[model samples]
Target: MSIATSVPHPAVETARRFARSSRTHDGLRCPNAAFDAWFARQRLVNRFEVTPVPFSRLRGWRFRSDTGDLVHDSGGFFRIEGLHVTGDLGEWSQPVINQREIGILGILVKEFDGVPHLLMQAKMEPGNINTVQLSPTVQATRSNHTGVHGGRAVPYLEYFTDGSRSRTIVDVPQSEQGSWFLRKRNRNMLVEVVEDVPDHPDFRWLTLGQVNRLLRRDNVVNMDARSVLSCIPCLPDEPAGGAYGRALHEALRPGSWSLRSDAEVLHWISDLKSRRELTQQRIPLSDAAPWRRGPAAITHPTGRYFRVLAAEIAAANREVPGWTQPLLEPAGRGVVAFLTRRINGVLHILLNARSEAGCMDVLELAPTVQYQPCNHPGRPPRFSRAAEDPARLVYDTLQSEEGGRFMYAESHYRIAEVDDACPLDVPEDFTWVTPRQVMDLLRHGYYLNMQARSLFAALLALA
Candidate 1:
């Protein structure tokens, strides 16, 4: 047996290198002082525009004659279909995005002066509040990288597709918004390369710490970038900066004391999956009752949740110059928050085992409160009041959701420190777990919801 055939594997070393990168806040390639001007310049030079249009104006897309589902002519991108769900909550029918293809969201890494740096792109999407945001090196769907849209080749895609060119650090399939996307998932990947790579005006090399700092700002880091960053392994030696950071550091440290054991947490999720009765059946878009299709949009009668609308986009930096497609426009801004409390000197966040209509697993761990304010005008989800209180909030930012598929969808992500007034005895659907427990579950797929993962990425910045 040789060293190449070692049992523990070389991936462990890759993780250690990533850990070192996370500690380096400044990089040799791009200094912290110059990042802001570079990002602003990308936004100014991109020249992105989006115009709302009627469904009839959508090019290469149509509502199916038989099923009334919204689809593309090539049938490669994705489709807007109807899902009928009956679960413990209640019975309801809503519109969901049915994209079966597993797209790739990969980040390329390299050492600059012996410190690991990531390759990030300033990408534009039609639905983004800000037209351009920091994204992964490659964020392409199967239809995209395969050139089904007859567009330019995706830049730096070979690094992800060709295994021999780069070393794989992290690769796993992660779920999107279960409520909106029907059983949808994308491949989250991180790869390292030793060879010299060319740099383009749209791309920049950033340290993990620099990326973490950007996460603190609102709508600066895209959802795909945050999702991929959350997959990086948490090292025990990372610095703990502030008062809250100290608690979080202990929570993420291996073998930290927690209120619930690892087995108990797994058992809780497993028990919910087994006991929760949820029945989902695919139906034609025409059959989705109470949702009416008008000239401008397909919307619910009350117009509370979301609507399907069409948009014409023109981008100077995309694979293609312009295209017309359908987008999901949310009714109003949403609120997703995690309520945390210090128990026995370790911080634990309150998680709800939420079951969405499109979740592959019946349920996944979600933030304490994930709801739209417009849906319940006066009434709010439990714990939201405390989470939103100015005195308790440690982290609060208005972040945008996946902009490629959504139109101007923004959510207020918050992390609040609850005092003794909030009870430790949670409802049956909720549980208390440490940050390390959540990180452990995040290594696998379909365990934590997209909002939780986004919050986790923001949480890492606090440290």
Candidate 2:
């Protein structure tokens, strides 16, 4: 990978703007944000059996149909007991939240007083790259969904089959809320909760290893269970601790989260992941030979190179002070980025000019690295031949990943111990795109906003 896409705050803002104009379902004519708004409108009251649940929680629960043939929300707000909502695709803002294995609404609940109650909601645990549904809520609008609540009401975990072998719990729970009741969808399903374990290291809640033992006959790596156990505060009245506790608390964040869209957050996350992966794929324009031509390339060589580039940039900053001042904040928040490389055990720089000023400074990147090169295109180069000089370099500017086809032969950069600071490398001139586009992909997956696709096109245009 060539570049590490820094946080894409701009892209994220663009995504939020696009999300506002989204619709729920086309035929249904629901705004894409309708469910989030609707769920947001409903608040979770304390100690309530059948009160409204925020849509965030309502989207994931498990339930069974009662005699009244209605849905009941037993665990939080997601599970509906009787009624069945239509297609599993109405909400596309978050794919993991909307795509329930059973259907859009996971199970059905029996209706009472013309309204449905909730059971357990099928929820996907966080930290998973993929969605692992536990319980789901059944929608009762009766659009076109066929659900599993008509027959015997079984634990929501039963719906999951490994496709290889059926997993069984050794011990069983006699009651509905028993640990063994719901089908567990992980390495270890909780068989039973252990008791009397002394609260040694400030043990306020159940431990993950205990949950793993209960669920797995053999030693199991219960990732989610460990996460949950860690989050359960030592006393519910006290603060959470330990590694697991810290991680889980951060993920859950206490209350529900609903926004016009997740475009911004996703954009930033995706940018970080994608660019990090391709770190070694970029050009190291900075460590190249100083410029004689192409006055705007990033490969200017030498201190004079930096001075000239910096001066030009500072001069530009004097014009549009607001837009350009961020360039020289003593930090590398410059609009133009670089792709660095390590060649023959030496580091080199490749500059990328994202905007107009960038286009100017980048040209000086190569030739400016070192002072004397008399316009020679070939020879042993400068730094490498300077025996016993660690601070010196050789800047034989190469246009390709393979420098054999040299662009500038003299004063080209080949710095010693350069790779230590520059772990990954990239070709210098390639247009850089932030990875946060994945969230745009998510929004586009639902087709709620056209800008999602348009934004992708704009990013692609950089290529």
Candidate 2 runs further than 4 Å off = 1-102, 105-147, 150-433, 440-463
- Give the candidate number with the greatest TM-score: 1
Question: Which candidate gets the maximum lDDT versus the true structure?
Answer: 1
Residue pairs in candidate 1 whose N, alpha carbon or C atoms collide under 3 angstroms: none
Give all candidates' CA lDDT scores: 0.88, 0.20
True-structure lDDT of candidate 1: 0.88
Give lDDT tens digits, candidate 1, residues 1-463.
1111111123556556666777888867998888889999888988878999999889999999999999999989999999999979699998899999999999999998877899999999999999899999999999999999999999999999999999887788999998899999999998989999998988999988889888889999999999988888756365557768788877777678888888888888888899998888999999998888888899998979999999999999999999999999999999999999888878899999999999988988999999999999999988889989989999999999999999999999999998767888889899999887877777678888899999988887776
RMSD of each: 3.3, 29.3
Compose the digit string of candidate 2's lDDT tens values, residues 160-273: 223222222211111010000111111212121112222211011212222222222211111222211211111121114543233222222222121212444344334433
